[model samples]
Target chain A: MTDPVVKATALRKCYGDLCAVDGVDFEIGRGECFGLLGPNGAGKTTTVKMLTCALPVTGGDLTVEGLSVKEDPRAIKYLLGVCPQEVNLDPDFSVVKNLVVYSRYYDIPRAEAEKRAAELIARFHLHDKLERPVEDLSGGMKKRLLLARALINRPRLLVLDEPTTGLDPQSRRQIWQEVRDMKKNGLTTLLTTHYIEEAELLCDRLVIMDNGRIIEQGTPRQLIEKHLPGGGNLEDVFLKLTGKHLRDE
Target chain B: MNNSLAGSLSYRAWYMWRRNVDVSLVTWKTNVLPPLLEPVLYILAFGFGLGAYVQQISYAGRAWDYLAFMAPGMVAVGVMFHSVFDTMYGAFVRLRYQKTFDALITTPLSPEDILAGEILSGATKGLFAGAAILLVVTLFGLAQYPSSLLILPLSALAGLLFASFGLYFAALAPYIDNLNLPVFLFINPMFLFSGTFFPLDGLPAWVRLLAELLPLTHLVNITRAATLGLLSPSLGWDLLYLVLLTPAVAWLAIAKMKARLIK
Candidate 1:
């Protein structure tokens, strides 16, 4: 794609002798939702961590908006937002305060942060729970608040690592809808998940990773059609390529 | 990855400090009580009760009331306890249980910023506790004016010193329980033997020499000197020690935390 929002070329991460992400390559165009589908220990989170500048890259090149991850991580962070896999909301902060405090990390001014926080609160349907501490919020509310906080900086690229990993169906659907809306608003997103349906619904193009490498990369339909000529879903393609053995064993 | 020492820190560190202050403000009621009451309780039990029986202790080359002698040391201890405990228990909770540092790393904040902020916040906590105890002592007529005013700023410096010391240990601690080792082994000894409750004059030479090595002893020396309006040229060594030690410890703390946080 011309002027991709994110580009990874032979990206690698190693911990001593154990290489977590073994030279993967992909590109995400602006406003497109890209997915990294994998089982546990598949290096999806490791790749996401590198993209978000949480971990140093061991080898190869990765860039966000033409800024190298190694050379300008701080500058790249200013242009991106990340929703981590874990529920790490500040337990001490109220729903509104959480957004406002996160905004400060981006050097967003107080007045503008408050204004944007108000808008996000209303949009996420958290206006009524503005004063409620994050610990008091339901799991779904917390997830929504995390999404809202990620958008507080008006990021050009949004990274969601298992955004709906443990949500109820209704909450999961709500998050999916919000993500779709973000895409329609032209926000480029890189998402990682093991859920087949979540990937099928959200990703415009995708990659399936296993054992530190991307085994397949294509649109959801193309991947399924290529793997199963006789009509089958993406899950069948995933199982066919990655096998049925439980990764955790 | 900008792993160099200077590149790891930036003005963004203040944001982390601001976040802690926000949390502290929310818990102000509970946070304010310990500093305010600890001195009074100590004075009532030790100063009034114990001092009633003991004769005036000779310190700074003159006879002084036991309460007067002990009061400034309480301020020093307050600085140490507040700064150390906040960075140790409070920062460890944020680092491990809360995963606050993980979230912060995704933002513009480098790991050093988070550690710097914790140290600064801990020092601020130290200042708060020290100032509270100072107020209590002043009300009891224990603090002398002018020179006593210096204690407010000195508390922050002492706070920075102890906070860095605490964060370094926090970074080394494998689990929250491991933090108890420092408290039991180091903090408790410093609290009792840092010339806080009594003069170091009659102690063994080795014990006095060891006390001179503990950061708290110097803090207490300067604080007691200031509170009694007895500042002397000898206190320059104490001031120099704190000044030189704080940044070294703070840099080491930040480096240790960076190694732990950054993979």
Candidate 2:
């Protein structure tokens, strides 16, 4: 509908002789939730890492907000917030300190960073744990903190790598609600998840990947119709597309 | 924000250090204090106990109190020893076990900034520990000369050099626990052989060369020169050696961090 905010053209990442992300191409429109759906080791995280410019390209190219990762990773980093698959906050730091101190690294003004950190703390319902260390918080609270920290920069594009991993249903739903709210504010999102429910509920369009390649792609409804016999829920569609083979990795 | 590039870097470093003081104090309590106190105790037991028998040991000109002559050397050793542990083992835990750098990397700060800030933090811890030991030694009257005040800044720079060394090594640590071997093997030997406990006068030529090779030897020599008026080498040469080492070690720290983070 609009100029693509993120463009991936034949993007690839190789570890020694192994090409984890092999020649995958996709484009995400502005203000849309584009998902990378795949089984484990499907190069989803690799793609997210490359897009975040945390990892070297190794091959091909990815452009975020029209800035090529190759040409301008630092600028790309400034414009995006990456919520990694793992919750790696400083466990020793308090709930609020983690977010505020992290924002300072982005060269964000301390007063502004603290203000946004407080707002996000309240927004994520972590107002109570403002002075408590992160390790003391439950798993769900940590996930929420990660989400809050990610948004502190008011990132132009938000990249979530398996955001819902290790989260319970209640926390997952809370996250879903928050993401929907983010969508209302018109923040573009790119995420990868093995959970079809997350993809179905959040993603506007997604690509099903396998063995470093895209097997199927489109909106939830479109993919079901095109790739399956019935345009049912995302689970049935995923089961049909990926088949009965268990993804051990 | 509106300063020249260098001013901004030092400002950012200071800001980060100021904010991290609580954590840094905890680090000093756990890591720097024990190693610092160990050297002070070594000076008291070894220096005072041996000073009576070795009354007129010719250090510079007049016979100095063995403890007084040894106090500044202990200060130098304290900065080196505690700073090595602070930057090596302590930083290793942050780098590998805690992955604290990963937390910092997500921010807008560059690796250079992180490197600079961490080194300063380590140096501050070193200086703090050295200062604490100096106070304890002063109470014991081992810090005899007025020139002993100069030891503080010299120890701070020495601590920084070792801190940079430790931070550089931290990037190479696969596990935080692996640092014990290097500390025990490399640094401990330097402490023993680098004229910390005694003078290097009686040692063979090769042994003296070994002592000369260590950065600790130069630091101890500089501090001892100030305290005991022993001018084996001028203050300018000693400062040159230490000042040259700071940027050299910082460059290595930046290079190692770049390799680790920019993957």
The candidate scoring highest on lDDT is: 1
Q: In candidate 1, which residue ranges exceed 4 Å CA deviation?
A: none
lDDT of 2 by residue, A1-249 (tens): 468889999998897889889999999998899899888878887888777766778788899778897776667778888787777787777988888777876778989998898899889999877888788999899888988988888898988888888889999999999999998899999888878989998999999998899988899988777766544788888887777787776
lDDT of 1 at B203: 98
Q: Write down the DockQ of candidate 2.
A: 0.35
Off by over 4 Å in 2: A239-249, B1-22, B25-36, B49-56, B144-146, B229-235
- Which docking band does candidate 1 fall into? high
RMSD of 1: 1.2
Candidate 1 residue lDDT tens string, A100-120:
999999999999999999999
Cα RMSD (angstroms) for every candidate in the order listed: 1.2, 3.6
Where does candidate 2 clash, by residue pair?
Answer: A105-B108, A105-B109, A106-B108
Q: Which ten residues in a row are the worst by lDDT in model 1 chain B?
A: B31-40
